[model samples]
Structures are given as structure tokens and as C-alpha cells.
Target: MTVRETAATSSSNYLTRAGRGRGGQGQAFRNCNVLFHILFTLKGVREVASGQLRVLQISEKGLRASSRRKDIPDQFYMCIGDRQIHIGCVIVSRKRGLLDIRFLNELPTPFVGAVAALEDPFALLEEIRPAVFGLDGFVN
Candidate 1:
């Protein structure tokens, strides 16, 4: 099987094991389910025609980290305020603690809730961050 398929299968197996371990323990199960979603959520511009690229916030570090991922698509874009910024991809820089953003287009002024507004999206990735992260009870 292909690497991607293998990875997907492994991830599924891990999730199944986790779910089984929680085993209908109401609250614990619920928390685990929520954690799974939060951990897998992706941050980036998905579609412009649908206004789906509107990002409210993201950590600079996260942006950099994401840029470095080889699997990231080439056409990623982040819409900030009135301008649209096209980024090639993001890479995480451990030392700088910031997202190494490479712009295919000029970096624009981030909107009031642009992803570029934050220094680290995951730093506040705990359950208390916001509904956007969706981990509410997972971190705690």
C-alpha cells in the first residue's frame, strides 16, 4: 500500500483503540471524541468562492510549521482584512517559535481576526482557547 494509505490506516487503528479504551464512559468518551477533532483540524484557506478562506486567527509559529510540511498544497492562501495573501506553504521553526511564511503574493494587513494576528495558535491550543480550536475539554 501507498505511504499515505498506510498512515491513514495506522491513524484509524489508533483511534479505534482509543475509542475502545474509553468504552462508553460517557464523559471520558466525549472528551476523547472532542480531542480527536481538535487535533485533526486544519488551518488555511480552503476555498475563495465560498468565502471559506476567511481566517479569524492563527499563531505565527503554527503558520511557519504548517508551511514546512511537504504534504501542504501549493495554492494555499490566507485572506486578511481586505487583502488576500497567497502563501506557498508554511514551515515550523522551532527556534524562532514562529511560522516561516513564504508569500507567493504580498503579505497584507491582517483583519481583526486574521490567522496572522496571533504569535502561536497552538500555544493557546488548550481547551480554553476557543471553539475554533474545538478542544474545549481535551487539553485539561
Candidate 2:
């Protein structure tokens, strides 16, 4: 089997063994389920997109870490210069390895320019400090 298929099967086996299947119980199982979704979501972000909006490695790490909190919002914002810029909203599904991100508006000029110049967008996100504003949590 292909590497991707093997990885997927292994992940599925792990989830089943961890009691995260259809009829799983206990808080630990639930937490494992959430962590699985977060990890796969970041993986999708890293592997799916291209061009100016491709997710950076550091940004993926940040997203993965922040996604551990249940209170984090579905959207992300970047703090650039004197403005808090709305970048996009992310919707992650528990049963799928893909995430849907909808941009709130046009990306900032500087960010676009940087990407156009072939600069690492993830580094730019890091330098600017991205923030997530959710109903119950604010993470930077």
C-alpha cells in the first residue's frame, strides 16, 4: 500500500484501540478524539493549499497547539502594524482530514506583496503574531 494509505490505516487503528470509535466512553477517549481532529486539520492545511495562501510549517504548529483548546474560535486574525487584520475562518471536521478556510476579505497589501516576493508567509504570520478570537477564548 502507499505511504499515505498506510499512515491513514495506522491512525484509524490507533483511534479504535484508544476507544475513540462509535461507542467510546471516558474523558480520555474524548480528548484523544479532539486531538486527532486537530492534528489532521493541521495536516490538511499543510498539504492542501498552494500559492500565496499555503500554510507555513510554524503556522501549522501554532494552529495545532491552539486547536487543543475547545474555546478557540473558528477564525484567525493577524496582528500587523497598528491593525488587527481578519485573515480567514477555518472549519474542521472530525471525520475528515480536510479543512475549509474562508477568507473574510482581501488579504493585506503587505502580506500579499510579501508572498508575491516569494517570502515565507508562515514567518510573516509569526512576525505579526496571529490571534484567534472565539466566543470563549482568545489565543495569540
Candidate 3:
């Protein structure tokens, strides 16, 4: 896994899987673009306690988010930016209250922009909102 994670030693297959495919010499979606304060929701079989999560940063393929609940399921569904659509995610790493996620599919460019375009919900205080672990498979 370590070798696969390293760009130098990573195979072409690994690169493709990572969305860093042919002709794109640099890793695709490696850069974290959205640094704005964004809050999104997480739903894991009613694991939500108002299931609000804070977005630390997000990229086209993944995101770093923080949650109030300690027990976030390894897989869950979440909204992208202000969009109502649910996207699947799988936890890649967890530490303290932070969750590092990989989207099941590469997000549309527009969706990524919407998250970056959003204003800080907490600072605004009165403000606004937003997986791939298909909720359809989960029981209530």
C-alpha cells in the first residue's frame, strides 16, 4: 500500500485508480481546493445527531471533514456543497474528530465549485447548508 501511495513507485494501474490517468503527469485531484468553512451532513442509519459535519477542505475526489459524533460509520452518504444529491464516501483515515474521505466516484466539476463557493455557515450563524455508502442497502 505504501508503494502504491507513492507516486514514484506507483503502477499505472494505481495511477488510474487514483484518477491520475494517462497524459495527466501530475496526480489528478491531489490538490485540495476548497478551504472555506463549509458544513455538510452525514447520515449512517440514523447515526445523525443532527449529523452536521464541518468541511476542512475538499477536492474533486475526496474531502477532509470533522464531525461531532465519535462513531461515524466507515461508509456513509453525504451531500456535496449545497446540492441535495447524495454522494457515497468511504473513510480512508480517521483521527481525533477528523475524517478523511474518498468519494466512490469522481465528483462533477460544478459540485466541487459549489462547496468552495459557499459562505461560512457558522460565522453567518443564520445560514445555509449541504455518499456513496448507498443508503438503499442500509436498514432503518
Candidate 4:
């Protein structure tokens, strides 16, 4: 597969199979704009135990909000302490408490700098208030 196709697959894979498509349906809601709306809405809200919000589960309804609409790419955003950190590739290994995020070729330079500064992944949710409503608010 071409880099673009591979990236597309990797990104959209976050959502359930039903959510993968251009037509209006599934978790993606068949509208990329709607995805961003949800993302921003999420960001606008606040939470009490904001730590859970750190590990962004990239999917149609998750971090791919911007890319899904622009037809760019998909990724997971690790929000830590008021910072929305993007991750191109992530391996959720709960046992290790490590969300191994692999950066894609198209990632921005500024985002690279941000991920580099991350010292601990476990304390991310609390450190990075990625969601507007925060973790507690989102889950509740």
C-alpha cells in the first residue's frame, strides 16, 4: 500500500469497522466536520480527574477529527496538562502502562518537540488537559 493508503488505514482503524467509510454512517457520522465539532466540544468541557484524558484513543470519533475532514491522516492525541500532543502510531500496552506512539512521516516539527518533552506517560491525563471538558467530564 502507498504511504497515504497505509496511513489512512492506520488512522481510521481506531474506530470500529462500521465507522470506516466515506458515506454517512457509523461513529465517524459520515461527516468529518462533525468529528471536529465533537472534538472541539470535548475540548471545551472540563473534568475533575483529568488523568484518563491523557491517552487519546485515536479513531473516527477521537484524534482524527482534523485529518478525517481534510482527508489528511489519522492519529491519537495525548493531551497532557493543557497541551494536545499528537501521536501518529500508538501501541496501547496497558500491562507496561506504555502507549508506544510511533510518529509518521508527515508529522509536524512542533509536535515532535512536544512529544520529546514528555517525561511520564502515566501521568499524562492530569498533566495535559487535552479535552475541553477534561477526562472526568468526558467519561461522565
Candidate 5:
């Protein structure tokens, strides 16, 4: 039998798949299990669509989020309740207000940990600081 090395581990350090990322090809990942204050702006666009959103799911590869902001282009920079953490993303699918996006790079473990450690990720839902357009270009 081939041994598979999974990411999430138990207290004994044995490999396990529970609570780990699921980004397999053609896998239909469940969405909207968690909610945290998230911010993002349309990539390549001069902030035409920048607003607060709720992170439905987060993984090493990307995110499943819900946003009311309209006209979201194909790409954007997502901020996990912070202005400094700009994660470049590309839209994979959109329906209603749900946005399935893939990150340009694998998310660092520490960053994801920080998100999971938040006392209340959705405490402040009214603000997205530095509240201005930062990403460059436009989606044509």
C-alpha cells in the first residue's frame, strides 16, 4: 500500500486529513462553514469593486467567500481583515454572492493560523481600513 503524507496531524504527530485543506482536482468542497470579516478589491482594477466580505472557507490554495459587492472582476487582492495582507486571487466561479477564488500562491501556515486564532473574526464588520484602492490596473 502507498503511504500518503497528509498535512493536518493529530497530537501525536501522526498524519491525518481532518480539518486539513481539500483542493483536489474536481473536488466539490463544501462552502460557507465559517465567517470572518474579509476585505478585497478587484485586481488590476482601480478599486472599482472593493468591499467587505465574509470568508466562507479558507484553505492553502484559495477561499470561498460571500460578497455583496457587484461587478467583481476575474482577479483581486484579498485582505484577511487587514490591509497589509494582500493575497492575490483569481475568481474560479461566482454565483449569487458566493465567490470561489484561488490564491496566486499557497497561503503561509502562520497566516492561516492567525486567521483561525482570531477572538472574533467577524467582530468588526463595518470597516475595511486604509479604505482606499491599492491594487493597480483594470480588468478589461
Candidate 6:
């Protein structure tokens, strides 16, 4: 299969694992935008360990490289599309190219919709966040 096909498959598998597959809650909000060329969905976001740490399940396209990184930094803002709102999260771990970001605060409900519609779901500063971690960067 081609690289794009593989990436799509990988993203699908991730959604399944997160229980946000074809007909899942995330599917309803999935839409296309013009930022990163990366199609993505917000699987879910919840607090862990008595609300000590907030975690976010995000599935994205083109993550075959960042999954191999040994160290992911902290305090990076996971920006949503071209909006000013950002969720402060740190990459806790990755599985099958799925990112499990640990957020410092619970993501606001309104922000979820914004993020779900983003073509480039993860941005940092003025650039796409994934590229900073050795991913292929934004497709757009």
C-alpha cells in the first residue's frame, strides 16, 4: 500500500482502539479544513488518577516518526486549527502512532469542537507541533 494509505489505515486502527471508530462520538465532529492536510479527530479527553492529570486521546495522520522518539518535551501548546485557543499538553506516550497527551488542565467543551475541525490539530508557536518531534510535518 502507499504511504498515505498506510497512514490512513493506522489512523483508523487508532480510532478503533480508542472506541471512536467509524460511528463513534468523534466521527460526528470530523471535518476537513485547510491547515495541515492531516485529517484528525478528538477521541476523548478525561482526567486521570483523581483528577491529578488530564489526558487527551487524539488520532492524527502522518505520525510514523514521532512515535519513535525517546524523549518528548513538556509545556507545548497543542493549538487547534487557526484559532487562538490552545490546550497545554505534554506527550506522555504514543501507541501505534496515537498520541496520549497529558494536559495540565481539563479541555473546555467548546474547545473540543474547534480542535475536532482543525486540519492541523496540533500546533506550537507558529509551526505545526508534530514536525518539531521528527514527524513528516504538516502536509499543507
Q: Estimate each model's TM-score.
A: 0.21, 0.27, 0.51, 0.23, 0.53, 0.31
Please identify which of the two predictions, 2 or 3, would achieve the higher TM-score against the true structure. Answer: 3
TM-score of 5: 0.53
lDDT value for model 5 = 0.52
- For 64-116, candidate 1 gives per-residue lDDT tens digits of 23222333332334432122222232222224332333333222222213333
- Between candidates 2 and 4, name the one with more favorable lDDT: 4
In the predicted model 3, the residue pairs found to clash are 77-131, 78-131, 87-131, 87-132, 88-131, 88-132, 89-132
Candidate 1 or 5, higher lDDT? 5
In order of listing, the candidates' clash counts read: 20, 0, 7, 14, 3, 0
Instruction: Report the Cα RMSD per candidate.
Output: 17.0, 16.1, 9.6, 15.1, 12.9, 15.1
lDDT of 3 by residue, 40-97 (tens): 3356344343355666676667777787667565556664334334566666668887
Using lDDT, rank the candidates from best to worst. 5, 3, 6, 4, 2, 1
Residue 108 of candidate 6: its Cα lDDT?
A: 41
Show where candidate 5 strays beyond 4 Å.
1-48, 117-119, 123-140
Sorted by TM-score (best first), the order is 5, 3, 6, 2, 4, 1
Worst 10 residues of 3 by lDDT: 130-139
Q: Write candidate 2's Cα lDDT for 67-113 as tens digits.
A: 32343334344333223332333432222333323233333333333
True-structure lDDT of candidate 4? 0.31
lDDT, each prediction: 0.29, 0.30, 0.51, 0.31, 0.52, 0.35
Model 5, span 84-115: residue lDDT tens: 44666666667877877776666654444444
